[model samples]
Target chain A: DAMVIQNPRYQVTQFGKPVTLSCSQTLNHNVMYWYQQKSSQAPKLLFHYYDKDFNNEADTPDNFQSRRPNTSFCFLDIRSPGLGDAAMYLCATSRDLGLETQYFGPGTRLLVL
Target chain B: GESVGLHLPTLSVQEGDNSIINCAYSNSASDYFIWYKQESGKGPQFIIDIRSNMDKRQGQRVTVLLNKTVKHLSLQIAATQPGDSAVYFCAENEDTGFQKLVFGTGTRLLVSP
Candidate 1:
């Protein structure tokens, strides 16, 4: 099954430490996205890569950064982890930038201590 | 700033009953809309989508209705089951250069046996 995959379903990091979350896809899609979802809230878009062109949300904090080295892999790096930043990180992929459907991974749950 | 929101924060329905979740968007320029279902501890799964040109779209057991006049979107699920219990969100895609989505607060659907 061609799907999105995320590493370390659960992550624990100390406050102020840096943490990296990874996402890879076998769907061979052209667009990849990263979203932060807190409890009982909607998934908020942090950044996305449309064929390696990074597009960050205007309100996204500078501590959150994303890199897509290639079509199949994308990483989310948090420069300084905070307790409030602990949430589920989701990775999604879509064929193009239009109204196409997006497929999402299981998500990486981050816990900041 | 424009936003998307849901009228109800939570709803409970009995098994085999039909469920309807409503959402309202402030962005009149949003051309695309989608409904997503997020299970506990997992990423959101795409349910259905409706475009501004169309008034409604249907999937296997789900249907999406779009009312451009009022900028309201709705998801109707037939034969609600326990498996359908989850958080449902409505997202609108802004008609910008990029495919950015603004999601609603979300409505929790609880299907009771």
Candidate 2:
């Protein structure tokens, strides 16, 4: 079954330490997205890649960054982890940049200690 | 700023009963809407979707209804079961230059057997 996959379901990082979360897809979709979701809140879009072209949300913090090395893999890097940054990080993919259905991977829960 | 929201934060229902989850959107330009089910410690799974041109669309045991005039959306589950307990979210897609989705603060559906 073609699906999105995220590595390290739970991660623990110290304050000011850098951490990276990975996402890979067997769907071979053209678009990949990163979203941050706090407890009991909606998933907030941080950024997304449409075939290597990065699009960042206006309110996304500068500490967050993403890289898509190939079609199937994308990585999210947090330069400095803060206590407030501890949340679930979700990765999703879609066939294109249209109104297509986006498939999501099991999210990575980040715990900033 | 435009956003999506849900009326109820949580709802409890019997296993054999039906469930209804409602959402409202302030974005008038949103033409696509989707319903997602997210279990604890997992990413959201797509349930159903409806376009602005249509008022309703049905899936295996789920149905999505869109009211463009009121900018409201709803998801109905028939014969709810314990396995249907999860956080339900509604998302709207904005076609502005970049295709992105705005998610609502989800509603927790607790199906009790």
lDDT by residue (B1-113, candidate 2, tens digit) is 32345453899999989999999886888989999999999999999999889998999989898988889999999999999999998999988677688888789999999
Cα RMSD, each candidate: 2.1, 1.9
- DockQ metric for all predictions: 0.52, 0.56
Ten residues in sequence with the least summed lDDT for candidate 1 chain B: B1-10
Best by TM-score: 2
How good is model 2 by TM-score? 0.96
Task: Report the poorest 10 consecutive residues by lDDT, candidate 1 chain A.
Answer: A37-46
DockQ of 1: 0.52
| Cα lDDT tens digits for candidate 1, A21-102 | 9999999999999999877778888888999799988889999999899999999999999999999999999999987788
**Candidate 1: Cα lDDT at B11:** 92
Give candidate 1 regions above 4 Å deviation: B1-8
Instruction: Calculate model 2's interface RMSD in Å.
Output: 3.6
- The Cα RMSD of model 1 versus the native structure comes to 2.1
Chain B, per-candidate TM-score: 0.91, 0.91
Cα lDDT tens digits, model 2, A1-113, are 99999999999999999999999999989999999987777788899999989999999999999999999999999999999999999999999998888889999999999
